[model samples]
Every structure is written in structure tokens, then in C-alpha cells.
Target: MIDICEESLKLQEQLVAWRRELHRCPEVGLETPLTAAFISKKLTDLQIEHQTNVGGSGIVGIIRGGKKGQTIALRADMDALAIREDTGLSFASQNGNMHACGHDAHAAMLLGAAGILCTRRDQLRGNIKLIFQSGEEGPGGAKPMIEEGVLEDPCVDSVMGLHIGNQFHEVKNGQVGLHYGNVMACLDSFKIKITGRGCHGAMPNMGVDPIVIAAQVITALQTLVSREIVPTSPAVVTVGIVNGGVAYNIIPDEVVLIGTARALEQGVRDQLAGRIENLVAGIAQGMRGGYEFSYTYGYPPLVNNEEFTKGFKKTAEKIVGAKNVIEIAKPTMGGEDMAYYLEKVPGTFFFLGSGNPEKNADYPHHNARFDIDEDVLWKGTALLAQGAIDWLENNGGPA
Candidate 1:
């Protein structure tokens, strides 16, 4: 609010550099040693207090203002995916990992915010915690960080995070996109194995065919969403990978199916899981093949806290202009590990548009051609800085 706009513009150049450096050396999951070291070095240089090795390569930077007030947290994920780069840019990923999810931009923008906040510490009303988390891609890094006391000592009053989105052009120009509740789906992975007797392929009725039984199970599982689950409630049960059979002449003795289920409602998730197990077991038994199913629940659906969301809405309107702030009507089936953080503390996670057709940055996330509009980097940096400051000043205390 204090003409941080100009500061943001100046920091744009710095952010570009930071982003390129990170882009060239992308790391995956909890093994972001280099990424964490870079962030720590920058925070240290800015005289910001921080902690390291939190929840495996997670780092937290604390900036205490001159006055006593509230504690607000701004988070950014630092993990990259196991994607090979094909963007053909000079600064494209040298390692096998790529920032297809735009986490590189998240880290750089937060570092930029750190710079602005450090320079204007006197104007700050409270404490700001910058969370550089790793392993957002899977095996969730957020829970471990929270367990390591990332949310304590200072005890954050409220927290916020932003993800980059390519859809919905009406809210372009790095606008903040917020949803009141159930912003992302809960993910659960499952594997089903069918056991049967092997026999010659040319023989008929000589043995049980696991492949045929597995196919029947697949068709039945699809019915869970289209027929069994409520139409109004969203849910997906996809059989992504199926493994069986060794030779054309011999019928395979067993078949294994792997897939995931996604749902916005907790009941839907549980119902689908139960239905899958029961249906698969019943079908396998009826077909003279024994089947077993195993499911592991992934991240829970991201439910944005309404109290924190109200603050974030106001903050977004002020920082990026009111016209740029938009409310997303429908939630995405995609899941975020940030749900782990929100589960422990009240927080809001929104989207920052990185799409710019003019710059050819229109590809969706995880695509080999994916790239962000570098120009929006400053806007993101400013938004995070302004949001943290606004939340602390308005809330007035950690409690």
C-alpha cells in the first residue's frame, strides 16, 4: 500500500534472475537441498530470521516488524516434477526435473516479497513467515513441516498460499482467484489384483481368466461414479494402469489394476472406495477369480477457511485492483498438498494467473511445453507481500 508498486517493479528484474537460476536446477520432492540452500542464503542476506531442514528440505523465513502486532504466513512450494524439459529456452531445466507446476515462480516471488518486507520493516505491523515447502508433488511435505512446528513458536494467526492457473481468461493479468470452500479434490490411490488359474489360450473353459475378470471389474468401477454416486456431487474413479499377461499362447494367472479416486466430498471419497472394494470382490468371486483391492488416501480436499478467505479477498482487491480479483465458481478435481496445512490451521489457498497468449505461456500445467509469463512474476511477488502486510495489520495479533 505504501507505493510498494514501484518496489515491485524494481524487484521484477531480481525475480527473473532468481526464477531462471531455479529453473535451470529443478529438484523433485523432498530432495530440494539446492533449492532450500538458495532460499536460506537469500533470506540470510536480507537479515531475515529463518529455520531450515523443516519437514525435509522445507524452510521457514520469519521477518519481525518494528511493532508488535499479528503473525501472518505466506507460503510457496519448492518441489519440481519428474518431467523432462522441452521448452527449448536457454534457462530451461538442466536436470531431469521441471517446474511444470510453476513452483519456481512461487519461490522467486516469495524471495522478492522478502526483499520488499525487509526494506520496509518499519512499516510492518507484525511478523511474516515465508514457508518454502518441498514435496508438493506427492508424499506430502506440508504435514511434516507442520509436525516440525512450522506453525508454532510464533503461532501463526492466519496463512495464505497461491497457485498458478492457465484457465479462465476473464481473470487474467495475474488476478487472484479464490473459492470459498472445497477448492480441490481429495485423492486416493488404489490397486486391485485378481488371481486365477493359468491355462492354454487355445483352450476354452479349462481355467479362470484373470484378464477377463479384470476387464469386468474395470467396467463395474466406472459405474460407481456415473450410476451409484450422486450426480450433483463430483467424483472420479479411473483405472489408469493395468498389468497382466505374459504371452499370447498362455492365459495369465493374475492381473493387477492401478488407479485413483478423486472427490470433493469426504463421504463421496469413502463411498467410492468402499464400493470399489466390494464390487471388485463380488465380481471376482462370481467369476471364479479371487481379487484383492488396496487403497491409500492421499491429500484431503482443500477447504478454504472462510474467515481467512474474507481477509484474502479484501487484500487481493487492494493489491491487484478490485477488477482483477475473481471468485471461481467450480472447484478443480486436482489436489494440492497445501490441504495438509489448511487441515492444521485456518488458511486460504488461491490461484494466480500465469497465462499470457501473447507470450505463448498458455499451456496447462505438467505439459512439456509449459512456461510462465515471466512478466507476471513481479505482480505475484507484490501480491504476496501486500497480502501478508494487510492480514497482519488488520488482524492485529497472533491470537
Candidate 2:
């Protein structure tokens, strides 16, 4: 509400510089040492109190205001994919890693917010925690950070973060998109192994066919959502990996199947592993074969707090015009570890549309050529800064 739009806009050049600098040397997963050091240096320069090496190459910066009030946290992911850059820009990375997911832009925007909030720390009605996390691509950094207590000490009243890219088709360039409830699916995975007696290639009844049992299991897995789950509720069960015998002439004694499952609701998610196991067990036994099954629950469904999202929307509307703020029509099947933070706290995650065809920045996330429209960087800065301030101004108290 302080009309920091102009200030945010003025830092456009700095934002681009930060993004490009980070982009030039991308690091992947939880091993982002250089990226972490760069962010710590920037926070040090801003004179913001922070902690590094949090939850594996993660950084947490605290901005305490003069007034007694609530606390809110702004988060940004810092990990890159293991892809080599293909973009012809001068800043295109020569290293083996790539910030193909717009994480570089995410960090730059949060740094911009830090700079803005740092100058006005004393006048604010609440405190702000800036979380720079790594390993969003794999293994996950959010859960570890939460385990390490990133949401405690100051005891965050609310939390928020944003992703920059074309994940949501409904949101155009420079627009902000959000969903009231479920916005992303759970990142859960499962593995199934079938065992049977091995025999010669020509023998049919001599050996139990594990391959045949696996085929049945795979086909039946698809029907879990189509038949078992409610038609209205969105869910997916995909078998991405299937491994068995190398030779075609022989029926192998064992077959292995690996797949991922996604759901928007907690009940559906909770039922997936058990349901899958039961289905697989019945089929394997019915087919006269033995089996092994394992299910790992990753990130939970990313749900937005209704009241928090509504409040943030008003702040978003003020930062970017009302016309630029839009509701995401549907939830994406893709998963994010940000869901972990939202589960433990009242918060919302949003999208900062960076897809611009003219600048050749419309490539999908995780692509080697993916890039962001630099013009919208300031808008991201303002939205995060304003969103945190508004949340704190409305809710007063701290840990």
C-alpha cells in the first residue's frame, strides 16, 4: 500500500543483472554452493540478518520491523536442472547445469523484495522471512527446511511464494494467476516387482510368466483413476518405467515396474498407495505370481488457504492492475515441494507469467531454451513485497 511500484520498477536493471548473473552459472539440486554464496553475499550487502547452510544449501533471511506485529515469509527456489543451456543469449550458461525452470528469476525477484523491505524495515507493522531454497527439482528442499524450523523462532503467521513461467495457460505475459484451493498435485511414487519361475524360451507352461503379470498390472493401474476415483476429482496414475528380461526369446523370472501417482485431495492421495498395492497383489496372486511393492509419499497437494489467497489477491490487484490478476481455471498435475510449507502454515503460492513469444521466452519450464520476460521482474518484486506487507498489516502478533 506504500506505492512501492515505482521503486520496484526502477530496480528493473538491477533485477536483470542479478538474474543474468545467477543464470550464467547454474547449479543443480541441493549441491548449489555457488548459488547459495551469491545469495548470502547479496543479503549481507543489504544488511539483512540471515542464516546459510539451512536445509542443505538453503538460506533464511529475517527482516524485523520496528512495530510489534505478525510475521510472514516469502520463499524462492534456487535449484536448477541438470541440462546444458541452449539459449543464444550472452548470459547462457556454459556449465553443465541450467536454471531452465526460472529459479534464477525467482531468486532475483526475492532479492529485489529484500532490498525494498530492508530500507523500510523500521516502519513496517510486521516481520518478513525470505527463504532461498535449493533442490526443488529433486529430493526436495522445502521439507528439510521445515524440519530445520524455517517457519519457527519468529513463528510465521502466513507464507507465500511464486513460480515464473508458462505453467498455467490461462495467465498471459505480465499477469498473475492463482487458484483458491488445490493448484498442484502430490509428488508420490511407487514401485512394483513381480517374481516367477524362469524357463526356456520355447516352454509355455513350464514357467510362470512374470511379464504377462506385469502387463496386466500396468493396464489395471490406469483404471484406478478412471473407475475407482470419482470422475469429478482429478487424478493420474502413470507407469513411466518398466524393466524386465533383456532377451526376447526367454520368459524372465522377474519383472519390475515403477510409476508415479498424483491427486488433488488428501483422502484420494492417502488411498493411492494402499489401493495400488491391493490391486497389484490381487492381480499377481490371481496370475499365480509373487510380488514386492513399495510406495513413497513425496510432497503433499499444494493447496492455497482461501482467506489468505483472497487477501493476497487484493494486494496483487493493487500492485498489478485488477485486469492483470486472474484466477487459474484448473489445477496442474505437476507437483511442487512448496506444498509442504503450505500444509503446515496458512499461505498461498502464485504464478508470475513470464511467457512472451516476442522475446522468445515462451519455452516451457525445464527446457534448455527456457527464459523469462525481463520486463515483468519488477512486478514480481512488488507483488511479493506488497503481499507480505499487507498480510502483516492485517494480522498482528509474533512468536
Candidate 3:
């Protein structure tokens, strides 16, 4: 096997520069023109066969080895958030949008992986597909990519993705965190509108107060999370936004509440939804107000295939040593669109710690201050490259 780690070391500066360039020109979900163009140019320069605009602004690069074996996919999200950059770094986001999720690093690492695999194609055992996805933050883009037949064209038997997290110490560099079974929770948002009679605030008893009704509904929502749901299972009901009266002297006719609910188990998610509806209706009726609830499902919970990830653990052990690989104690509540890919094909998704406090790169994801240790970029690239090549060499073809 070729020493991918050593090769990755030589490409460190190039990867960091690429990541910073992407960071500066951050784009929102499903509209990554400049980002896709940059990826296309790099792939073209490397002589890698690719397909652009697969599933809306996403890019896919196919590098074939001398001998064909199994086809595996390595994916990375390429979209930034709507938040303004506050880090004040030299390569801070140009516009209001910023890479608060470290997707810029993910994209750069995958690009670096492609370069390494292409240069060492002679030693590669099978074909590798590089997928640069967009809109992973919300309103999923993975389903569309899968619907567009990116996986079918190459007949990918398995897929893998890496996320950067700010959870570990500097000495924990190159560590791989894995979780079996459910690794992320299902997310769904709900909007509730309460209608009531509007009257002068001076005589509150003259009309049904929507603000009071909304407050009651919000408090009642806690019963579903605490009193009714199973104690062992986890669930949350948060009312992040509530809008009602415009003036202090006048009571508004309607109050609108918007927020989200998350649960690891599907049954729990369903139960919570039902309970929320009942609670809202009961509360509104008690206050002589009418209520309507609108719900929309987001990404499904991420369930990692145990057998597939067992194979991945061995690959990680070989590439980064056993000491660097650690199994997660518990799954996270955050949702990821990578779950869509795993639903189609068996795979393992993991986190690569890129937080180094000493370098002031330890902010959490989605925070404006969020930054990542660029050194982890090379390690991530090497790991993805080795995982794809190693899996094919051992598994041969799709089962």
C-alpha cells in the first residue's frame, strides 16, 4: 500500500489555500456557482473525469484505476450558512454568508483526496467517485442527488463522509469518531397559529388574548417532552419564534409560533407530533381560541450500518493507528443529509476533530466564530483516499 499520509503531508499548503479560497467566497445552499467552478477547474487540471451540475450545482469526479473492482463514493458538502463572518481572518467570507459548518474544509479535503488518488492510481484497487454536495444545512440536497442517479451511474456499493467537529484537544488530532446504529436525530419544524378576538389592552377580559394563549401553548408543549414521552428516549420541543401583537395597547387577533422538534426514534417523533397537536388544541380551547398547526419533516435520523462500519474501523486502524480511532459513547442530536446516502447504500459517517484551542480554532459548528485547524485537512484527505482504495481491495465487488 502507498503511504497516503506522507503524500498528504506534502499537499498540506495546497489544501489549506484551497480551503481558505472557498471560505472567502462562501455561497448559500444549492447555489454554489463559484465553488462548483473552482472544483471543476481543479479536477480538469488533474485530468480527472467528472460530471458537473449533478443534482443542482453539485460536482462528481470519477478516477478509474488500472484494474476495476468495487465502486465507492466519498462525499463532502459544499454549502455555507447565512450568518455573517465574525472571525476577522484574512480569508473571512466576502458576503454575509460564511462557512460556519466547516464545509469549506470538507470540500478542500475531498479535493485533496482526489489529487492523491489520481496521482497514485496505479496502486489503487478500484474506482472512486468524488461527490461535492450542496444544501446539507437545510432543505436536503442529498435526496435530489440520489434521485438524479449519481449513485446508479457508477453503481456505488458503499459511501463515506467526514465532518469536522470542535470537541477534542490539540493532541487528539487525526482522531476518528464513529457511532453504530442511530448516529443523528430526525428533525421536523412546526408552525402554530392561534386566532382570537382583538380588543383594547386596558380591558383584557373583553377579548381572548392570543399572547396569553400562545404562552399557555408553549408551556403545555413541555408536557410532551417530559410528562408523556418515555424517560429513556430523548425529545425536544422549542418555540423559537412567537409573534403576536404589534402595539402594547392593543391585543393582536392572532399569534404565530414557530419552532422544531427532534427525536432519535421514529415512533418517538410521531408520538411527539401527536401530543403537540393535542396540547395545542386543548390549550387554545381552554382559552376560547382556535389553533392550527403546520408541520414539515426534515432529514431522517442517521443510522450507521454496524457491519459496514466494522469494516471501516479496520481501515481507520490501518491508516491512523488503533489509538487514534474511538467509538462514540452516544449519538448526536444534530441531523445530517448523509443519512440519505446511507439509506440508499450501506456506509459509515464519522467526525474528524479539527479543533485546536491553542490556534484559536475551537468554536462550535454554526457559530460565527467557528474555525477549524487546517492541519486536519490533510489527515482527512488521506483517510478518505485510503478508505475508498482499501475497501475496494478487500471487498472486490458489490454484494
Cα lDDT tens digits, model 2, 136-171, are: 998999999999999999998889999999999889
* Candidate numbers, best lDDT first, in rank order: 2, 1, 3
lDDT by residue for model 1 (289-364), tens: 9987799999999899998898888878877888888998888898898887788778799888888877779888
Stretches > 4 Å off in candidate 3:
167-171
- Candidate 2 structure lDDT: 0.93
| Candidate 3 Cα deviation (angstroms), residue 140 | 2.1
Per-residue lDDT tens digits for candidate 3, residues 269-377, read 8898788888899889988999999888788888888987898898788767898898887777778999889888988888888777887788878899999889788
Q: In every candidate, how many clashes are there? A: 0, 2, 0
**Considering TM-score, which of the candidate structures 2 and 3 is the better prediction for this target?**
2
Q: Which residue segments of model 1 deviate by more than 4 Å?
A: 167-170
Name the lDDT value of residue 179 in candidate 1. 85
State which candidate has the highest TM-score.
2
Superposed model 2: Cα runs more than 4 Å off: 397-399
Q: lDDT of each model, Cα atoms only? A: 0.88, 0.93, 0.87
> Higher-lDDT candidate among 2 and 3?
2
Better candidate by lDDT, 1 or 2: 2
